[model samples]
Target: MASRALRAVVAVSTLLAAFTPASAQEAVVNVYTFRQPDLIKPALDAFTTETGIRTEVLFVDKGLEDRIAAEGENSPADVIVTVDIARLSAAKAKGVTQALEDETVNSNIPASYRDPENHWFGLTKRARVFYAYNARVPEKVMSYAALSDPRWKGRLCSRSGQHEHNLALFSAAILHWGEQRTEEWLRGIKANLSAAPSGMERDQVKAIAEGRCDLAIGNADQVGFMQTNARSPEQQEWAKAIHIVFPLFENGATHVNIAGAALARYAPHRDNAVKLIQFLSSPRGQQIMAEQNFEYPVEPRLKASTVVQSFGPLTADALLMDEIENTRQLASEIVGRIGYDNGPER
Candidate 1:
């Protein structure tokens, strides 16, 4: 249907469009991210607006360490942004991340939120919570040990036990209760699953809304996503069906996880990478993440978004990062040994 002249220039137009003049000379920082792209874009865009440094992002759902290692020294990954402390530890262990000892970055974040050797820095904090169908479930607060009660034998729903989120929680449990007790606790949880470990945190929320389960374990941000999901109106219904219950450990503190950033070891654009990270740790950067992603900022002066704050006060346990990272492999092994993924017996 196109004119002959227009048809003749289409391929040429496409070729020319592929190579922008700025691509050849502008400062650019490449990022490998495990967190959703939209979640970090506001802060990255703010960074570019402030410093004129273009950010290039690649999303990898899994195996980021192996991919970065495969690329070796030629990897264009100047920065890595991801969730879960275990993955960050693994990247450093794999020698893909370099220590970042920036004074500006250090001043912006707390020592508890950044690595001791400075390989990664926590950007945002989110709680691991329970979504319970309010109409059917009355009791609000829960102790992790209560998960095994026979009353919940067919009411519990979760993502895979080996998932980084769940694994991190299990690792924390190992440190809190010891491996023998943690394994027994995991076995009890497995015995109560409504379905086989399946889908994402959002899917577990959906299951609760459908009345297929009464209690679902998931991260707090999924509730924010569902409530704000204009693209999927049905998800708003899911959000309305339940109330978030912050599960407590025996010591009365809740489990929290972070989304963090690191510098790649072989970064070609080292200065630009450091600049991006520094910007990401600034008050403006922290604000952007808090407002857009429904997460708690790493900066103590700033508070979580209003929606996040409404989930109830988060009493974070004094979890040691090194201890949690060290115990994660054992957590995965326990999941395997007990066949936690097999779900409850019919």
Candidate 2:
């Protein structure tokens, strides 16, 4: 009787283990993202619901590439998300990311918005637009070349030129106008700063509101933040002071930058990582990105947030992102050469 009772106990234990949820076993994907947690949480929650694969996010504000490289083969990271082509290129250049060859990813993302070798894929696009005080600069149209016009001397504000946001714009300048012309343009812009180019995008708008400068350089999403009371009542007041001007390249299209993601080279959960990337590039994912993040979606079929749509139509620069990536180092060199962040020369 004792032996029969022991056998029954063993059978029940084995059955219970077999029926345990797969999610409870080993279903997880780790993400190392430079993107803010709030911006990506909703999409991640949806992914979990659809796939039963839980996501773990580590929001690394800086040194993401260095950390991933240090982990080497033992890294627990399954994917990396970042803003700007510079960081994505840095990840690839540092050997922390691998190429992805998925049909869903390839089909959903435009070639210009992704790496030629598929190392990274852009999820959203934000134009490098101008934020001009409505009362001071009422002309609705402007060009990148025109920011240097003598009439606006000492009337423009910008963030550090070396920052990824400005570097991407400077890189596009190199691609469109060649290095020499771009350098000249940078010097002209440097000469026009009302105060040392400092502060976040919102700060630039605030500067305009405070009468520090008539014009500022910032992205389209910042405009959405300024216009909507979603962030703060003060920001809405800043929005009231400025109007968005889509600055065009001499060739017609405006320079734009992106927020993107890449699969880790040593991803332990490779399939799950792939699914996450595919999901982010999908139309549904794009919609979530638009609504939650207030950025323009990569998928054309997915409408932008109502606030963004109100900014009016945009014509993105035709230069390939890879082209911009190649010019990033040169752009930094020009920033330093021109003393862009040191404020206008006395």
Q: Which candidate is the best by TM-score?
A: 2
Using all chains and alpha carbons, the TM-scores for the candidates as numbered come to: 0.89, 0.90
Residue-wise C-alpha lDDT for candidate 2, range 122-201, written one tens digit per residue = 99988899998988899778899998888889899999998988999999999988999999998888888887888899
Error of 2 at 168 (Å): 0.9
Candidate 1 per-residue lDDT over residues 271-321, each given as its tens digit: 999999999988888878877878778776788888888888788767866
Error of 2 at 291 (Å): 2.5
RMSD per model, one decimal = 5.5, 8.6
Residue 213 of candidate 2: its Cα lDDT? 94
Instruction: Compute the lDDT of residue 185 as modeled in candidate 1.
Output: 90
Candidate 2 backbone collisions, by pair: none
User: Any runs in candidate 1 off by more than 4 Å, and if so which?
Assistant: 1-26
CA RMSD (A), model 1:
5.5
